[model samples]
Target: MGKKQRRMEVFDARARYYPSAKLTLEELSYWIAFSRVMGIGPVRFQLLLDHFQEDVASAWHAPSYELTRIGLDQRTVDSFISQRANIDPAHELKRLDRLRIQVITWKDACYPPLLRKIDYAPPVLYACGQLTEDDLHYSIGIVGTRKMSSYGRQVTEHFTKELVKGKITIVSGLALGVDTVAHNTALDNGGRTIAVLACGLDTIYPPSNYHLAKHIVDSGQGVLLSSFPLGIKPEAGNFPARNHIISGLSLGILVTEAPPKSGALITANSALVQGREVYAVPSSIFSNSGAGVNKLIRDGAHPVTEVSDILEHLNIHTVPLPDTSVLREPENEEERLVLALLSREPRHIDDLIRDTELAPNIVTSTLTILELDGLVKQVGSMQYVRCT
Candidate 1:
């Protein structure tokens, strides 16, 4: 039999198994099947959708000739044909359900709004945990070198804590070093975070962070997301592509610390290409670990020193400070010194001490008094911000 005839025969045989009664599920199954096909990415899948009038089931059943005519190369058409013949779309959906993986397609209402605006956004996302509207809207990608230095660790933790205070959901690759620190800090601070994996949801890459991934899902703090179909391994080549999704899902990308050759830079580049803001921490010239972010700053990425820099650049309005006039006036010189040094921007106790030229004992006591008086609020750790 001819290729078209064979395709028809396969379709006919599976007609009864198709979830035709549930049009949405049926269409989604076809989309999942296409996602499993090699060589068919977001751009090609979109072409099929357009040619088939947004009917993914029709696209899946389209003859080899029709697929080729619609711009799929012969190689891709052959891959699709071979894959579709063996892939029972309904069975694929069942597998996802069994694994508790939620699939978000382009047509789904819960699809990330920021991600949808990117060029060649993934046609489907496999999520292993809940994705809230807050996660989709208030996320920032915090990525850096896997072999992070002490400075990198400190910077990542500091920024993560401050951003979490602003109610920003952190997004990271879930790699070691900076990515790990970003996720942990966000979680520790009781903020939601999302981990974008290069592999399928079935296997968490770097196996060591499995517990971390579990914590993210189990705590209901965030989600573990991927574009790759189940059974896909985390190959070296998958990461660069994965970086695109990281940037795509975020309102902006932040490079806390990265070497010149770090993959974090790739994500930053993707952010710039996607028209998303790219922020980098200023790094020392002597430090190799800081080269990538320093270059990023030189290339016009926003050099961020504080959380407000990011929030302001994104035009995100944080919670308005309470009016200080209602609060009791400062009772001592130490109280006035500390209050004068604090603002809506968070300031660490050490910085407050150094800036105010006060004793550590005095600064700590003044901050305690201010907290009690509602004149200053401790955002997290020892960081304090003015009530007004």
Candidate 2:
């Protein structure tokens, strides 16, 4: 099939599954076209709909002066009028069929219900994975900083593992540090994870996680998700919007570690605005990594001292860790020493070296093998933590 035809197939699939709006073929196109225009966000789009009574194509053709009467700014009203003739809503409608990617609009019943309550929910969302009502009803939002302390890493892994045991789908921006830790840890625990991106699904930010994204989708254990169309690139400002989406779809938000001004903090704030629960894992007051979490706790966010701290808050059962089993084979002498140094919290590598009485190179070598086998994870060059 041609790209256009495939795109239509996706739209058809979504139309079949969607449960809202008596959208005719024309209505979906008008809604999608409005969402694509710059300077016309969800709020302004609503004004247009209110006046046109959801006759989107008619709204698009309404006089510019009439739009202004409804209080659209002069520039935006003019912009809309000027773009109407050139913007091809039909092309986008056709492209959805061409790409073979499913499209779910506000009219669709399969649209994530939690997300609909957000302030600026997208008019249309594209899906690559199978998203059922069950997954939507059981998502847990996990977020953290791109640079993490050993303690932060441990907390994220521990909480994510517990969420997995509760049959919850983990959601996070696929950033480095805590986000990566959350997704991988959930997968490690035999659970599914969903990655919300700041860019299009066609583009992977922090390219290192590309393999992990593939791994999630390939395993039937998780999915890759995004709101941007196929061609958009990640801009710095896209992250805050991404944060809203993360908190929007989830039942709650957990901050494993972050600086006070970090994007994770923004997510917590958005969660609050969205009426979702916010949880934080306290870190050392001395470490900058823990400063955001500490502040969150001070501001009345719940504290998570252990996995159960969060599970208990959500009224979930925490699964006990398996008794330490013998490794299929030891990776190296350092594996023995590094393993000895590990506990529930991640320790700095220097701390590990001092405690293990091993050479740095040997310790590093062993940690690498342990990481590959999913038995251990390196939180820092000098520190390692067993997968929580």
Show where candidate 2 strays beyond 4 Å.
Answer: 1-21, 315-342, 345-388
C-alpha positional error of residue 201 in candidate 1 after TM-score superposition, expressed in Å: 0.5
lDDT of 2 by residue, 143-196 (tens): 988988667777787778767777788999988899999999999899878888
TM-score of 1: 0.77
Q: Judging by TM-score against the true structure, name the best candidate.
A: 2
Give per-candidate clash totals: 0, 16
TM-score of each: 0.77, 0.78
Model 2 lDDT, full chain set? 0.75
- State each model's CA lDDT, in order: 0.83, 0.75
Deviation of model 2 at 210, angstroms: 2.9
What lDDT does candidate 1 reach at residue 314? 88
| lDDT for residue 313 in candidate 2, whole number 0-100 | 70
lDDT score of model 1? 0.83
